[model samples]
Target: MSLIRHAETSAPNIFHGAESDVGLSEWGHKQAGLLADHLASRGAEAVYCSALRRAVASATPIAHALGQSPVVIPELHERKIGPLSGRTRDEGWGVYEESKRRWIAGEVEFSHPGGESFADIDRRVRPILDDLSKRHKGGRFLVVVHGIVIRVALTSLLADRTPADFDAIAIDFASINDLVHDGSRWRAEALNLVVAPSPARPVA
Candidate 1:
């Protein structure tokens, strides 16, 4: 299985939540094509994506390239930012950082207002993985989703048994992380395949 983070979003740095309608940026468009070509070479059996627009846009071209329709799974969405939906970067990151701190300290129920707790993520995501495992069963497939979703899924596979790990690891845009599921167990192969690198963030 292959997990690909959706290409650079129109709202690239904000705490884009479930309700965020941000699509791809101009550079993200080109990144999508890069991802498409890479997946085309790999010959994926099917292409799946989060319901988010950016994720869909990211997957559509790749699906077209592979002659398959992109499947949108609502469960594959990123962690919901709730009240922090459209905050400035610093403000949102401030809330996000503190939330992560409390969450890592074992406060499983801690969440931004109207947002998902870490447990909520697992509860929603497990079914998706279970459904996919049965449907795909050893088949190589593509899932285009968000950075945080991939981290939580990978952490779950590693038996971390936690609801959150906001700082899990940095997964760049348009990157592919390879994994394999043999009916019961799951394991990752490669990670952070930067197909089209974005411009470096300016120094703060």
Candidate 2:
């Protein structure tokens, strides 16, 4: 299966997190179209996405290209940033980054004030992905989701990697992280692969 970060958001600099429900930027829309075009030849049988607006918007074109409607999964949403929601990185006082640091250092319970812990995100997300892998078995599928979600999944699921590598892993907007299930464990095939040129601005 392929886990794709959603296209650039309408507010790329702000911390939209799970609560903010924003859509794509103008360039993001074009990026989504290019994403769809690129994935058209991949023969994905199903398309799944986070229920958040940005994820749904990103999946729309790809689902259309594959002649399937996107299955919305709430558990696949971005990690909730809680108090930092809607704030720019500078305005948020680096709380998010610090929380990530703690999480990577084996403090799975660490969280921003009112935000979810690494364990919280893992609990909600991993089961769904495992189930999807079982259901698809030998088939290919696509999941449009957030960068943090992708990063968390990679750190948790890949045996050679751990949360310590989370911050070092950069999941760019619309980039695809490909994984394969061997009827037992998940393995990475590719990661952070941007299929199309991205906008000049930095990603959220």
Candidate 3:
């Protein structure tokens, strides 16, 4: 399976977590097209993405290229970021870092009250993966999702890790994360690979 992050957003600031439904920026649309071109040859059986505008836009072209439609999966949405939503960059970044500190210590169950928790995310993610494995067995599928979701998924895959481990994964916009299921287990082949040239980045 291949996991792809949505292309750039209207506000491409760091630690911009838990953003509500928003569309991509001008360049972000271009990134989606480039991403489609890049994945057109991969022969994916189906495209799946979070039920958000950015994810839908990113998956649209890819789905078009594959002559298939994207399946919107709410379960794959970025963990509800709660108070982190729409915060200033520094403030949101601080909250994200602190949250990671907890996650790194293997506190996967931690989360904002009234928002989606990492443990809850794991609960939602497992069934999708299991379904994919059973239905698509050996088929290549693509998932367009959020950074936090991707990180939590990987963390869930680890057997028993120490502190600061899950924090190592970095997901950039329009990056590709590769996963393979070899009939028995899922293995991560690559994480956070950018397919198109990104625009000049603004300082965080």
What RMSD does each model have against the real structure?
3.5, 2.7, 3.3
Candidate 1 pairs with clashing backbones: none
Top model number, lDDT: 2
**C-alpha RMSD of candidate 3:** 3.3
Q: What is the TM-score of each candidate against the true structure?
A: 0.89, 0.95, 0.89
Candidate 2 residue pairs in backbone clash: none
Report the C-alpha lDDT of model 3 over 92-175, residue by residue, as the tens digit: 776676667777777777765546667777788867967875778878899898877777776666444233567787787889
Indicate the TM-score of model 1: 0.89
Candidate with top TM-score is 2
Tens-digit per-residue lDDT, 129-183, candidate 2? 8899889889999999998888888999987789899888889999999998786
How much lDDT does candidate 3 score? 0.78
Better of 1 and 2 by lDDT: 2
lDDT score for residue 49 of model 1: 93
Candidate 1, residues 120-156, lDDT tens digits: the string is 7867886887787678886878889988777767766
Computed on alpha carbons, the lDDT of every model, listed in order, comes to 0.80, 0.89, 0.78
